[model samples]
Target: MDAFANRPLSPDLPERHSVHDMLVGAGLRPTRQRLALGELLFRGADRHVTAERLFDEAVAAHLSVSLATVYNTLHQFTDAGLLREIAVDGARVYFDTNVKDHHHFLVEDDGELHDIPGSNVTVANLPTPPKGLRIDRVDVVVRLRREEG
Candidate 1:
């Protein structure tokens, strides 16, 4: 099934909270670049975006933000649990603002990301940790390819 086919195409979603609020909620200082970048990342509908894609979008929108700023903001967001980093491939990293426990399906042909609800997957018993090390998170990325007809 085409994951995006069933998705809604509406444009009137509610605006997200102010950047200052987001920064305060995440326990980070609301710097100028952080404010702008936070608005860009979280103001709209939730999305799975790469840093390169975000840079391009910022430039196209005339937002004069620097690449370093984007990287730094992304790092901060990830550290604060406001964003979830997904390693679809070894090199390319995608950032998702939805921090809920869920999985993703990546279409290899076009780099499309589809969110998989957590309720659909079941987890059984697992092995215990060896020692002081603890389990931080579990992320699942299923890469999809078109099957020959």
Candidate 2:
């Protein structure tokens, strides 16, 4: 077996430290698992991810991580403002890499997610928040089904 095959798919030093700094800046401890997971999640362009999907990637890349750990770390990252959690339904949830304010298009048939510019959506008559609470943000998931002949 080749050494590279078993190596963790982390980035080079500068990038690796950049990811490390990102975690620290977000108030999260930069542990080995967190760094490894961050490396995969931030591999390329910003996108959405689920704990299950991340776990699979970790396993594929031979990273020593568990599904439960993925879930915990994802939640921590979310709490630290490093990721945005998009709940698709009562049972499924996804973590979005793009943290900016925006809407989403959920392709119902395929369970795909696409970003909708914030300017494209307008919400009306939102019920007032509780006396001491304020509206942080609103999430709109427009469900689209495939066209039928």
Which candidate tops lDDT? Answer: 2
Q: Which candidate leads in TM-score?
A: 2
Q: Model 2 compared with the native: what TM-score?
A: 0.87
Off by over 4 Å in 1: 1-17, 147-149
Span of 10 residues, lowest total lDDT, candidate 1: 1-10
Instruction: Write down the worst ten-residue block by lDDT for model 2.
Output: 1-10
Please provide, for model 1 over 34-88, each residue's C-alpha lDDT reduced to its tens digit, 9 standing for 90 to 100.
7777767775577999988888888887888888878878988888777888988
RMSD (Cα, Å) for all candidates, in order, is 6.4, 7.9
Candidate 2 residue pairs in clash (backbone atoms < 3 Å): none
**lDDT scores of the candidates, listed in order:** 0.75, 0.83
Local error of candidate 2 at 95, Å? 0.2
